[model samples]
Target: MTNEKRLPPLLKLALELGPLALFFVANAYADRFGFAEGQRIFFATALFIGATLVALAVSYALLRKLPIMPLVSGVVVVVFGGLTLFLQDETFIKLKPTIVNTMFGAILLGGLYFRKPLLEIVLDSVFDLTEEGWRKLTLRWALFFFTLAALNEIVWRTQSTDFWVSFKVFGIMPLTIAFALAQTPLLLRHEAKKAEEA
Candidate 1:
């Protein structure tokens, strides 16, 4: 196996966020670039698929392995994006976020049902926590993912395509970041408690 340096946090964030940024940009300017209304969604979906593949390739190059969440998400993007293009239906792409988020939420909650706090698997490298802390954090994240799924459904059903794209790009990201930051205190407390016990 080849040894590879772990990606820096900023570079990791860029790899994850860059594809969504490209999708949003492509959609926003599709019309000015002379794509018809019907063609804009297809154009954006194609761009999104390409960007997601590039992101995955970059992640593997840096980390020497694909991250689970992004691998799952990239698969969904490519499949749904391809359906959107093949069927010429924008709804497939619109529904992708809802499906992906719901799947994640279900998996997390299901892990709890099986007496496993699976968030630890994803986050253990970055955090030290008691079992109770892991359980609480996992529950919080599961609920958050469900909330995001519901929000995506509501936005796509009620809002314009452009509005939904903006919400996906701007709203969901900030909310996730804020939620993660808000958990810092709890994480620190758990770490301290673990240290004390040690």
Candidate 2:
């Protein structure tokens, strides 16, 4: 028998996304726990932080190492989570995504300024592409993440909490699917070339 133990990439992605799902659920159900408004926010933040840590552990077990992007994301979760709990404010927790996405966008776009494509480094295991291809792919992801940040601000500012929760689950996920689908031609082109070379 073989010694293979690692999980597939897509499964790993699902596991990684699981914590965010849990965070949203915990926040939505906050009142049921009979927590005070400040307590509920703190409790939810604690749960979110715990969920992220657990997700990170599971991901590491499955993949043999922490995925860098998710690790960074988890760090933000914990940091913002701590701040939210300390300040007893929901605003800090809510702003976490904006800070994260904006930071990612800045780093990505800035890498392009230095004539480097940082996405290739992070996604190297999942996809193989040349420098130019990596550059384009990186730029696309940078823009997409920044767009998500803007949309988060818009939704949180204008909508009810319930609506934002629904959008966080239903809206952003579908957008991700559609965006990934749009990249199919790019993946296929590289996949075909790899096939030919093999």
Candidate 3:
């Protein structure tokens, strides 16, 4: 049970991004299968949920159960996914990520009220940080998600549907990757304890 090498952070990010990419790609092609924009969005979301299930299956096969953060995302996906199907509207599906991210941000930030860094519960398996380090990191992430939600609302509301779709695939995805990449230096700077623990 001793593999000295650790999985890189980018691999974890890929696990999360893979399903989103699948969603975008499927949405781009759904019309060929007779789906209109709304139906395309619904199917795209369903496809994302399906991808999440597949990821969960693979995660369980490799690590058992689900990763904490992804588990929360999966739950929201199912909840919103149900609404998308029942109501037969794609907007609900489009808003799913925003809802999940907003909730996550609020919950993480709210934990500070109790002087706890609850984010550590989800992230501890991947990274180690001192208590203060965790608190600051958590705060930043909370704000980041909140801002992302706001941005999502603005883009999807004001832009043309084609523009919004392009934003999802090009704008948001790139921004997220850039943001994640920017975090690596911070992670490395805080890697002292994690390195020891590892």
**Top candidate when judged by lDDT against the true structure:** 1
Query: How far does residue 145 in candidate 2 sit from its true spot (Å)?
Result: 1.0
* Alpha-carbon RMSD, each predicted model: 2.6, 3.6, 3.8
Q: Write the per-residue lDDT of candidate 3 for residues 65-97, one digit (tens) a residue.
A: 676678888888777877888888667766876
Against the unseen true structure, what C-alpha lDDT does each candidate score? 0.90, 0.79, 0.77
Pairs clashing within candidate 1 = none
TM-score attained by model 3: 0.82
Error of 1 at 97 (Å): 0.9
Expressed as tens digits, the lDDT of each residue in 91-130 for candidate 1 is: 9999999999999999999999998999988877778788
State the number of backbone clashes in model 1: 0
Q: List the residue pairs that clash in candidate 3.
A: none
For residue 147, what is the lDDT in candidate 1? 96
Candidate 1: regions farther than 4 A off: 1-5, 192-195
Let me know the TM-score candidate 1 reaches against the reference structure. 0.94
Best by TM-score: 1
